[model samples]
Target: MTRMVLGAGTGLAVAGCSREASALMDDYATVSQAANEPVAGLTLDNSQLMGIREAGLQRRVSGFLSREWSDHFVTLDNGAILVDINARALHYWSEDERTYKIYPVSVPLSEDLTRTGKTSVVQKREGPDWRPTPNMLKRNPSLPAYVGPGPENPLGTHALYLGWQYYRIHGTNDTRKIGRKSSNGCIGLYNEHIAELFGMAQVGTQVLII
Candidate 1:
């Protein structure tokens, strides 16, 4: 399967409502629809792609089918992030370049997490503090009150706060956890990957967790 790269073309130039905005929306819609379809002449059975078959995941995620970012997300045209839990990957769309770059990531282990949907980046911070939520504290009472920015900090060096309740996309001190299911309902990226993504993202950037 071809990588998820849209041809080099200009994306939304100026932010806000305009004709370009409408065209970008239409372009994304076309892209989304195409993703759901199986690519012709590609035999996925023996193909070895990044998101290829995992022992116990759904075919939609494990197969060669290109799972596009959902229609519910609105800012792919102006730059956005899509997190595919089953694939354990984050797709970063650069609005200016009109291209996407995939990064291996970690997601929540719990299957019951219901935070999947569209949301915007509410805040972004570097050298972020790690404050465990009350629920996280309940799950593990030994958690410290907070951890300041440093190598010991679980949030790593960069963090993007989500519009959803208490969720964030942040870097991790443990790089080994990337490309696995080992997070507390938040998206976890390698420190280097998060640094690059942080430079690409901004406040109000759309995030789609699928």
Candidate 2:
């Protein structure tokens, strides 16, 4: 899927509620219909790609095929789309960019919104203390220990603060929920996973929440 930023007033620019808007809507309908036209499954030699009888070759994810953000998310190699959502898990498949693959991101259900320019500060620490800030205490009102790097520290190593105090994407003493939802606004990942992401993402990587 192509990731297009819907700028403010873009709707107005595309078409208005007046005659122009109706015309624009018609054009959109046409384009949408064409794009939705069914095309046979991906194939190699005029035959289904999965039908090929080759060693170590077979389509693993065979279920619902839908359009989504993976559409238009062009691969860096040939500017082709990359699909990240599938039944298996958060997958990234880059067409044309034969060398790149997508990874899964376990975003927490933080108490914050995923907005643009919502900066993230990464702090790396092992056995980092979980000092309950005054605000955090106000929210929980019964948080224990409230301080010191310990087993219960909420601010796991490599904290990505989102200006929303007490909210972050940090490491976890619990590794079971690395790829699932189980956090309070802060994204949880395996230590090695965050470490890898930290190295790849720069200080200002755009974190889009679709």
Candidates in order, TM-scores: namely 0.68, 0.42
Q: List the lowest-lDDT window of 10 residues for candidate 1.
A: 27-36
104-189 per-residue lDDT for model 1 (tens digits): 66677678643798888889999998777788778667667777887667777899999987799998765545555666788877
TM-score of 1: 0.68
- Which lDDT values do the candidates have, in the order given? 0.61, 0.35
Clashing pairs in 1: none
How badly does each model clash, as a count of residue pairs? 0, 14
In TM-score terms, candidate 2 sits at 0.42
lDDT of 1 at 53: 36
The best candidate by lDDT is 1
